[model samples]
Target: MTSQSGLTRRLSDADEIVPDSEYVSESELRHGSDQVVRETSRSLHDNDTDAIMQMFTEKEFETSDLLEICGPFLLSDTAYNVMYMSPGIINMIPDTSGAASLPVTSLFHPDDRPILTETLSAQTHDGSIMARLKLKDCSYAWSNITIRQGNKNIHRALYISNTDELYRSYITQKKSIATLEQKAADLTRQLEAVNKELEAFSYSVSHDMRAPIRIINGYAHILETDYCADMGEECRRLFDIILTNTGQMNQMIEAVLGLSRISQKELFITDTDMPALVKAVTDEQLSAVDNSDKINIETGNIISTRCDSVLIKCVWKHLISNALKFTAQEATPHITIGSERKGDKVVYYIKDNGIGFDMQYAEKLFGIFQRLHKRTAYPGQGAGLATVKRIVMKHGGNIWAEAGTGMGATFYFSLPVTDQ
Candidate 1:
């Protein structure tokens, strides 16, 4: 048989194992009465105790020492009856004095009994299992258990490691995710309700508000045509002013309704030929205006983008119309449409050699009914840029303008590039 000092040296090496010669007979293995047997048992138990104590005291250990150090561990038979337990286990568990020879399930919470039973049942002597176990205070802790088979498949050593903090964090994160999901569902319901109210309001504005405006416009037309011959020049001029103001009011109301409709419209995104769309809008606008010959339009290489074609067409129309209207006084109106790639998006811009506004008011440029130029000079209700901004926003894009007084203006808009 191997000597006690030799066995102790082998255990100290941690990586080396004591040979079978070191083990005593079955009777001595159980009772450990022989001097050599007693010393070997004491060495094994002390080695584990020292490693575990070092772990708790110094908070560090080598990997080879880890199996012995990670404790609150147990030694059991194949039937999961507790044969022996580490000192740490006795200290960690309350009322465990008579725990020896009892089923391992006694140490677990009632809810966790099945977990230990299943792990013990499925595990071979060579394999191990992990589970969360309850403590004396009723709090749960995560543990990793490792098992080592002994001679005759009779005895096993189980190494346990605490992992309570990690499990607790995982549970907290799961609850947080559940809470966020509930909040998202609540927000979705609120959004749907708001959309319904907006739809109703839009319907009322389209029908109820426009009816009176149309009637006023019709009466003004009748007064100009049917009563013009009977009225003096000053009265005719007054009638003219009434008709003009009514027309402006009608445009403003239409612009507001258009903005509302665009917001409600569902986007049908597709690969749109931006150059062709711009050309079409400019052509249509040119056809409607009398000063089309005075305007010179230039277009650069424009890449195709995924967007709502109808809404984008509206955007281009408003921009082109604004350019033409602002530059109408110029001897030669110059307008350029072009685009370039910027990171994940394509930025398209319209440059106009026309009368431009101060950059200080740029923040208010896209606001509804906000005007930098007088209505008498510009001949618009200042809703064109606002409508363009809304359309751009609907397409997951943005629009802005750069300008200086009397120099020129460039309007830039960006659209994300997506596969067709």
Candidate 2:
């Protein structure tokens, strides 16, 4: 039997290995020892020492030769003792050695010892196992070990090959996933902070800013009510201009606040009937405006969709009211609303016969305070389209318009189809 120190020194030097059967080359390792053992055992019974002599003769081969031809492997008895180790195995298992004394388990990582032990302990003794095997440098390499039983003097043969590259790739993949998860968490925190700032801005616009405008408008109204009759024609005209401008400013301020609210509002999504929602908004707008009986309203198969009912209603109110306002000057104002299926989405459009702007400026139509017509000609702060655009985008939809001067404008929006 060899001592632990002796085994370590021998292993470090890359010495001989033990195999379960007669001398077999590296290429023959997978073939198992059944045929070799049977032939060698028969030869031994006939009093021949040729096989034994050949094993020692092959052992004289250089370690480099073994490394090139064979990977690290070991031969052990049924009790798992270190018997014969190849020159390749010797260079890998540097810490222990003994003739039928040291267990091959000593060369395995502590974490992998139980796995190998359980594999060998199984009823089917011949099986494959994966574990980290110790190297001469005291590190470990991932190795696949296959143990096959022998019927001769040797009990089992252990064939081991390194799979370190595959193991390292798995480790790298885990690290990359962790990094992505951390980045996602950071982005969520940043979004939350931005939303909080928006909330505060909305509050300021609703209260801090509107209060002074309200006071100015109130005083202007009082002056008109009490002093308009006493003023000269020029003075009265100037006062009227002041009152009108102040009122327009208030409307602009309200539009800005509405835009802010749209951004901050959380969506309450649900299945809503498109025709019902549109008709309701249209009725409300018509009842509030003049010539309710004059504007010709038309429709098509506007399909039902999933969306935030309140926000979607706001969208309809803006579009319908916009159509009615622009078409008010026409002798026969016509408004049409309809939808059509386009692939996986439902495209809804509102068109009106009115004094439309040129297509070249279409891109600016949805921007806040961007207006092609003078406020004197067509009154609005130009935030309605911007608000509508925002609401549509939040629903994961798109909005676009097409028109020419003196012709009608058609505003189209698409929503993802949920029913289908």
Clashing residue pairs, backbone N/CA/C < 3 A, model 2: 7-97, 17-84, 17-85, 17-86, 18-84, 18-85
lDDT of residue 288 for candidate 1: 88
Off by over 4 Å in 2: 1-163, 218-229
Residue-level error in angstroms, candidate 1, position 4: 35
Candidate 2: Cα lDDT at 178? 90
Q: How many residue pairs clash per model?
A: 0, 6
lDDT of 1 by residue, 365-400 (tens): 999999999877887788888889998888788999
Tens-digit lDDT track of model 2 for 3-58:
22232223333434333233444445445534544544554555455654565478
Candidate 1 wrong stretches, greater than 4 Å: 1-164, 214-243
Model 1 lDDT, full chain set: 0.76
